[model samples]
Target: MSEEKAVEENPVTDAEATPVPEAPRPPLARRLLRSRTVRAATAAALAGALLGAGTVAWRTDTLPLAGSSAPCWDSLGSGSMDALFGDRRTEVDEQSLHDDPMGGTGAYGQCRITSYEGDRARRQVTVNVRRLDGLRGTDAQDWPREFLSSGMVSLGDGLPGMASSSRAWIALPQACTGRDDFTGPTVVDIGMGRADFEVSPDEAPRDRTALTGALIDAANGVIDGFGCSGTYREPRDLHPPVLWDSTRTSMFCGIKGLALPAAYRKELRETRASGEGGPAQVCEAGYDSDETAVRLTTVTDPALSEIYSSDALHSGAPVKGTRGYGKIGGNRAVFKALCQTGPVMFVLEQLRPAGKGSRFTFTRDLLPAYVAAEAERIGCGPQKLTLPAP
Candidate 1:
């Protein structure tokens, strides 16, 4: 996972001065993999922003990801691995999350990035575990082959591990986790590379393998700490205590049919993500099907477990769920569902096509059904909770 930036990046523009919205950025997975260029650009951007604003910056050691509710890589911390460069290493921590619902295999994972500066070599490594989810059939046996195709490696004896001369990655099996809420098959990406992007034939092989072993060991240490590897997966709930917000979006469409939906599958048009909000109360919604205008949105808020209650209503029973209400009609349905205590909510909707006789009428229980079904699907179930209709 060498992030080398070869392209000449454009000059920076003052986002604060711009009144109009900036152009949409590329998908995170593609951008993150662009290597050093992205990092340099990001640093430059931050520097420019600070300088232009005449602000002083303070560099802190062991920074916990600020303003983020996402999990930390503390489990895979420095102590997890034996020293690679003796006392010559300086470890910085980074924790990030990414999800690519439409990126073929549907990837979403948390990562920890660290760089070691030594007189011998300056190297950076990132360890990530991304779940392929419903896109891959729920079979443990086929995960190795499926993960490798995604450029992730399989490690351990029966465990899948991958490593190139400069990088190493693997897939952690869900079978090892006792959490039923961890409903999908997951893959891990553990890659390390020389900071300067230089590798020698003899040096590369030995270094890469050593890095690979270290990463695998670190990942295993993480699993050992939690007693389960999949616990890091988002949206997992224990006994419906709290929902962490559903991170997997590709699996939810207008619904499906017997492992596959024939009629609905043919109506697929496009899937686009839309939202511009801060992390505390962020919102990301997308269209799963354009033909029927099927769409979904997962809501996550810091006060979720304590203060979230979709305030949605249903036919006085408050069960079927709330509709995106007036957003769409005439040909289909639109509604919202409050899944659990984490206050994870889903806004599932379907719009009718504008046509001569198109009429939208769905079961009143559709949204509520979605709530119950998805809850069951992700192992969040049996709480029998619903948002109070306001």
Candidate 2:
């Protein structure tokens, strides 16, 4: 059988003979080119080897790679704010300015943009921020009266960093040193540098617009770069020594530490007096209705105890318990209550039906309550609340 098959295959023509089979596998070069993992690994190995040999690959940067140099840590300095001065083209001579732009400061830092070569005239901007020491609210107050025309700028809420700038007159030598008498607790004060002698005295300099603008810009830049958020606006509960010391405030009101009736609100005007009698705080009412108008005043009447005494009640202001009740006399139906607490006094007067006035009108309410209430509010202890006798 094998002889017959060989004889048949030999007789077959080369075309009819099955074509010799090619190699079972691809060539070494083809095999290598077809493999993705092998190609990538080989390329990486070649690159590392070249780098080790101090030879860089051509168009290496064009190749998409991950590793690169990182940035340096940012520096902090209140003086060298050159990077913040985007408007400053060329650096000129600089001088340190020292002045409390806002009055009553614990500490202050100031820097100036002495000179810069810009499209406009040689302008300068000074950025000054005075800390309030152990306080917080002054930083967010409106700009000083000097910059009254200038508006307020806020970096939104939560960021205490805010700024204000104005194009104000720099009167040659008079204001050459900037304002030295300004007062307040301002956190960020950015204004044009007044040291520049080339300024008009009568009117604001025309080129100073840029200087003022630069101050505002630089101030914001510093706040952003230095992470100065939540540092400017402080809404504090500033109260006078006595609530009545303020003519208009939460502490001073028509009723004893309480708001007046809406009808008498419009007429609630405060009047205060301090003299030989003592210090008295008062709130007088004004109304248009036929209803009675009340007048609440604080008097330093020296004879307060004597006048409010039962003996003096028949003649002058009368006293009953902690209050003195009486009429305003004549056809006017107004009654007055006097509460003298040591040296301080608060008087409450209520309007009544004409000719029918009674001192008990204010007795129902504790007119003298605030004498103790205010003392307590101020964290005072054991005040002489008992009324003094004649």
Candidate 3:
């Protein structure tokens, strides 16, 4: 049986045992092309690439996404950015003038001029003018306006032009009655440089003229008002003389003189001589403890010191050292000082900041010469003239 095993069926043929030979692998490109899924995928990919390229070309050709406008692009011209942002600015022209609501009677004018002594770096003087009209009340309100306007406008336009320009603003109201009892005049004001002036119907022409002349004179020279003079003193002085007129303008000056307290007056009188600088009563008002007295112990004598401390406790003893405290709005302290000086009153205010001391010094030093020059131009007598309502 063993030998016969050789007769057992011949070993299986290699062909029958082994599997059939496989075809060679296809190239990557060929494989892609052959399969429907792969081919479709490739076609889709190509279409996407073409679309991207078209988009880029269109953007570059039409307008760049960055820096889309010119360097000088303005919404005002194109109305593009303006439309987006909303227009907020309005145009204004100098040719247009608004009509005054009060029957077109109100008008304004201004003038300014600068006097240069050297090159552009050096300026010797500046004058300004301002004028306003159509007011209906007290001269007090109008006087200040006229003064300031004439001064300010002179700085821009010459003094001659300022006077001429003011004429247009001088139309008076039709029959302004004193009985109207109105608050004050309505004024339209203009400014040139530093000076401003306004005039109501109430202001007298003579007063206006005087003020104008004074302002012009001041531009050329020196002038003082409201306790401020064209004069100045050395900066080192602790207390310099003030420019004040007790005889001319008495309202503020009188009030100032009477404000001293009694205690201060007693101290000043006792310490200083009677005539040296004692307070003197200038007005008709009677001085009695009942009317103006603060307390029995503390009094403002109104004779020695326009304002003084009556109580020895509150008198000279420093409140917080150099700084003293007094009743607010009361002139007891002032009166005490004035009583010591008598009828005359003085106010010493700095005309300029300490750093600009030179300007003040120059003004004072040249004041006499300036005043003389001003007298020739405007006449030296009183410029103000009072006239009854027409």
Query: All models: lDDT?
Result: 0.34, 0.29, 0.21
Which candidate ranks first by TM-score, i.e. highest?
1
Backbone clash total, candidate 1: 21
RMSD of every prediction: 19.2, 32.5, 41.5
Runs in model 3 lying further than 4 Å from the true structure: 1-104, 121-242, 245-252, 255-259, 263-390
Per-residue C-alpha lDDT of model 3 across residues 143-262, encoded as one tens digit per residue: 333322211122111111222123212111112101112122222122222222223334433323333332332221111111111211101111111111222112211332123233
Per-residue lDDT for 159 in model 1? 31
Of candidates 2 and 1, the better by lDDT: 1
Summarize candidate 1's per-residue lDDT along 30-95 as a digit string, tens digits. Answer: 433332212222355455553234332222233333432212233333433433333444444443
TM-score to native of every candidate shown: 0.31, 0.23, 0.19
Question: Cα miss at 375, model 3 (Å)?
Answer: 34
